[model samples]
Target: MIIELDMSSDTPIYVQLRNQIVKGIGKGEIQPGEKLPTVRQLAADAGVNTMTVNKTYQILKNEGYIRTDRRLGAFVSENINMNAEFRDKLESELELLSAEASITGMNREDFLKLCDEVYSKMKSSPIQIST
Candidate 1:
């Protein structure tokens, strides 16, 4: 998928890259077993350093989102491990978001409807990996 990084953002580039790749997987833009660009190639494409891309890859690997190989580069993990910790984190984030929505005058139905719309849009979009 196409990843656009905001250089001025306080977040590190590697973190941004890692997050985007995760989102891509969530949206089905990056399919299981799909090969990712080599660290050098992605660095050049994103105009960042190879180390930055490598760091991102390492983080993805640790999170069970992707795997790396000496010869094959990185590939999306066919099976993501959704452990209890992951569920706890997901619930925590959702709770925070729900609270924010409630504070903003969004009813439960409206919030759920918005979530469905966004989820559908993400699922329908085609994945475009940059060379």
Candidate 2:
């Protein structure tokens, strides 16, 4: 997967890198246990500093999205846990986004449809919605 960074955007380079990697994993572009490029290699490829790449990897590791081994380097985590911390984080983010959508004149149905569309695109299996 190609890592694209917007230099002019307000988002930090490391955050952008982290988000892209997370999205790649969600989209199944990067498989579980798949090896990722080394920090030096990714830094060179992304035209960022090694420290920035290192920071991104550290964040991913803390989030349980990736794991690192001294001998084999970093790879995607075989199992991702959707524990309380992640759920809380997800809830907080969605609450903010939902408020933004409401303020921007999006109705409940439209907002939910948009959410479903994006979610469906990311998951390989069919989505089951419960009322």
Every model's TM-score: 0.84, 0.93
Off by over 4 Å in 2: 125-131
lDDT of 1 by residue, 2-117 (tens): 99999999999999999999999988889989999999899999999999999999999997889989988899997776777677888999999999999999999999999898
lDDT of 2 by residue, 1-131 (tens): 99999999999999999999999998989988999999999999999999999999999999888999989999999877777778788899999999999999999999999999998768473323222
Query: Candidate 2: lDDT of 75?
Result: 100
Judging by lDDT against the true structure, name the best candidate: 2
Error at 58, model 1, angstroms: 1.1
Model 1 residue 88 distance off true place after TM-score fit, in angstroms: 0.9
- The CA lDDT at 119 in model 1 is 76
